[model samples]
Target: MKDMTAFLPYASTANRPPLRPKLAPSGAGASAYATGPKAAKQTQTLRDNDDTELLTLFRNASFEQHFQPGSTVLLHGDPADAIYLVVSGTIRCCTVDSEGRRQIFAFPKKGDFVGVSDIDRWHFTAEAVDHVIVKSIPRLTLEQELAVNISLRLEMRTLMGGLLARRERQMLTLVSTKGPERLYRFLEEFAATRSGGGHIVLPMCRRDIGDHIGLSMESVCRAFSDLKRRGLIDLKSHEKYKLIGNAGRDATPLPLHADL
Candidate 1:
């Protein structure tokens, strides 16, 4: 659940601490620091622990809500007193350009976090893409709970690390990719986030996809048709897709670390 301006390069530095900290033990335990199965297992265990704690936080916050499709959940510059956890439906976050054209930032999915920025105000407006369910957590409560619980603190630190990694990947894609590549990569990466393999259902329409990826609706459609002709993806419908093998890039995208 990472929602922040981190995906967009910011001119002003954020207030949050470094996501990855140097935790190498000095001298004494250095021998055990070598890469091995135990170290890998420990890393996995840490992630598992953090997920459990995050679930607990969501439950304790107890501010569950449902929004009808197209409802505004938050506005740009709203008081940043809380963050959100989506249980279902997509949240489309956006902001207006200087010329008043709306620019969609992201389509955050189930289990995605919204407003995870450390700033005092929202950076973008968030709207329900469909019927949406979420848990809203006050920043004060989140901070107080983290302060008293060492395990929770550790979990938050780890989660933030993953979020930072994702933000980096997104920024890189946005800065570097061409239209067709961005569209293809976006679909590939978004599909990777689904726990169920293949047969991906895009939550956003073509216009939404174009807005997020900095492309035109025509470009997105053309890319899809191209990929379909190339047999890279099976288009059951405009929104439904089936990913075939041999995409001729890296392996299937790692989940959550997606943008273009």
Candidate 2:
């Protein structure tokens, strides 16, 4: 198959595609939207944090699914029923070859969406890396609703864009760089994620990371050792990693997106 990531930009989109905004800027054209209950809702959504907005969005979801650790959410050939919104826990997206080799593409966590595909059958399988809860909306429902909800439409588009960016980053970084750079990029991305109180916890195991990046477990371990030796990152435990600044980070590092 063709490597689509080769052509993808290693950085974030310089200018994202313009979405029709619900909140209009001040001026003559803003006359209709400037004052109303709709305008007040938009204003509040803007002022409120992302979690609040996400909560509001999920309140209207068609349904939800829960998966315990190691449970499958989607099979490779399963008919695409709905696009999923992750409420909690980690989802491991992967595929198994004819030889039964597992190649994981990504690990999407909370506040992420999955299962957007062009074909009716799923191209990949999604399983819970940990206990997972996801809200889902049927394809027909999303298409019909998105037409009316501008904000939801924009968000869904943004989610798709985020997936593209992540795949690009993953493939480009894995194939072009050594294990150290891959590890660094992974750490940097996760640092910005659920990390708090001076520590960044890695959600994937060494073997999973190795499989995802086409590296060996030994190589991944070596990369971690090298990072620690250079004081770039401190390994508190197998799962807990603390970022110590980008002491030896790549000058042109990849921007890792989570919603793959």
Candidate 3:
């Protein structure tokens, strides 16, 4: 009805190489990219063509669907009849506690798949973060395709492994890091993979960001201020920002570029 992380598989960064700063090798931080370029390269290799092949199969069986901002894509505990392929816009996966506090787990963007983890019922609620389009492929169809196709099955396994790795990295970030560091790391990953030309357009609002990063909205604001103060980011507006340099605590010049 209202609120979800189902460990949704993200789009591969194979086409767009990571824009990492040449920071000296330090202890592994909680940031997802803290594994650095080598780890990212390994991940990219694992994900190669998985999205393309998965989409091709799912598209053959899926029907097109659309939603506006704040619309519920799927409810928690509903039968996991189908998984969704994001064609456009973003899906906010999160849950609400008894106190009505929300916690965001992931934002499933274009080329990402949602509801892949569940076999019978959905674990979290999926909400449209903005105007969205998705391809809804029935669970049975997906299972059948996976069963008959060895190559597809192996690819899906690799894809799921990558998703779990990222989920683990993010969990570590949430548990070990404070608000400002968590927010900065989130921005770094998004800028490296999703944004281009040092420009970032936040699809979700501050509240959503706080929910995702385990901070209050006020804290999220403070974190943004902190980034600005540290010269890590130039906030053109609340929803938009320009990346100035390295977001690391060392505060060196780091430029970000997105091939996509």
The per-candidate count of clashes, in order, stands at: 1, 0, 4
Per-residue lDDT over 190-248 for candidate 3, one digit per residue giving the tens place of the 0 to 100 score? 77767568568998888789989999889999989988877778999998887676546
* lDDT of candidate model 1 versus the reference: 0.65
Q: Best by TM-score, which number?
A: 3
User: Candidate 3, after superposition: displacement of residue 77 in Å?
Assistant: 0.1
Question: Model 1, range 96-185, lDDT digits (tens) per residue?
Answer: 544334566678888888877654877777766666677777788878887798987787777778777976787788888777678778
Instruction: Sort every candidate by TM-score, greatest first.
Output: 3, 1, 2
Off by over 4 Å in 2: 1-57, 147-154, 246-260
Specify the poorest-scoring 10-residue window by lDDT in model 2.
7-16
Off by over 4 Å in 1: 1-50, 247-260
Collision pairs in model 2: none
